[model samples]
Target: MEKISSTKNSKVKEWVKLKTNNGRKKFKKFLLEGRHPVETALEQATEYEFLIVQEDFDLGELAEQVDNDKLILVTKEVANHISDTVHDQGIFLIGYINEEDWQFPDDLSGKWLVLDNVQDPGNIGTMVRTADAAGFTGVVFGDGTADFYNPKILRAMQGSQYHLQLKRLNLEKWIRNCKDQGSVIFGSILDENARDYRKIDVPDQFSLIMGNEGNGMSERLIEMTDMNLYIPIKGSAESLNVAVAAGVLMFGLAG
Candidate 1:
């Protein structure tokens, strides 16, 4: 194992690149900050690219659990340089990006969450996490959604990504495919014509499309859905946050 004290070290700079999506794509890797995400990675048996830690962070029993060959000790300055959060736990793991193509499951009896143009990283991550909690099969990230490896998104996910399938595909294609697979696709929209979410009966298997934060679902996708459902708000709020709305719908429809 190597001890790196300089932030200017080549290996340190390479790790820093994992902070950006483009950089992550170029390198085919991403960084998981702190213990929880790293613990999830370990539980999933994700291949270790590097296990970096500050000099003072005692490995304790954890040192025996992980591959010592991949371990690197770094100075406090170097740890700060690679970390995105102001208060990082002084430990991080470099893990490969999940680039495998996720096929539509042969048995389409499971619930699915489709995110269309949801730009907020926290919202995107929270929805993914909620989808996992609601027993959804997977999440399809449509075009214009935040990159899966964005730091804030990863932080928000809290390692739930390991528990569910995530894929990026065109929403139109996904919608058509879901229809062809005998799966009911419900679109969440705010239009006057949309049925109140409470009126719709939850099915054993379905695809729920949550759309952009500001504009709601696009017209083209809306037209393709079997039904457009809306959460009726009795309160004065203009609309529920996309993630919050998704939690309500996922639990109501998939729970």
Candidate 2:
């Protein structure tokens, strides 16, 4: 295995760049940190360029799985410089981002979670993980939503991203496509005409739109949805967190 001792190493500088969106796009790679996510990526046969570990970090079974050519050992200082967390795990993998153009299918089916300008990395990760648990087929990231490559978002996903389909596209065009395919689109919002979430029958294949944390869904999207839903708040609390609301609706409507 190759060892990199200097924080100023050429490759070390490149790895640090993976932390940002532009860097990821430029390099066509993103950093996967921690044991679970790195292991999960390996198990899923993700295309990766390197399995990075701190000098003293134990690889254990992982040592047997990765080829020596793909392994790189870094000093503590190098690891610290590349880490995005308060407590770095000292293990990471650099995985290639899929650059193939994703074409929307002619026939759309299965339950999908749609994010409309949701910005929080934690919330985005929670919602994606929740969608996986709820057995949703995929997730769509609309304009203004956080990028999937964000380090915090990747960590928040906890490797759930590997199990589900994720896409970024214009919401207006996506909604129109779903409409053309005869799929029901539900928007979560509190409005005079919005129906109670419990009262609506869940469809086998549909898309649920969770909007921005503060602004909610856009007016154009609201008008375009087949039906708008409101989770009636019984208590004195002002509103549900976007991630929490998504979980409730995903499982509630999943049936």
- Give the alpha-carbon lDDT of every model: 0.85, 0.90
lDDT of 1: 0.85
Cα-lDDT of candidate 2: 0.90
- Stretches of candidate 2 off by over 4 Å are 100-102, 105-107
Worst 10 residues of 2 by lDDT: 99-108
In model 1, state the lDDT of residue 241.
95
Count clashes in each candidate, considering only residues at least 3 apart in sequence or on different chains: 0, 0
How does candidate 2 fare on TM-score? Answer: 0.96
Q: Stretches of candidate 1 above 4 Å error?
A: 101-108
Which digits, one per residue and each the tens of the lDDT, describe model 1 over residues 99-126?
A: 5733544555578898889999989989
Sequence-dependent TM-score of model 1: 0.94
lDDT of 1 at 181: 79
Error of 1 at 21 (Å): 1.3
Tell me the tens digit of each residue's lDDT in model 2 across 77-112. 889999999889999999998864145655568999
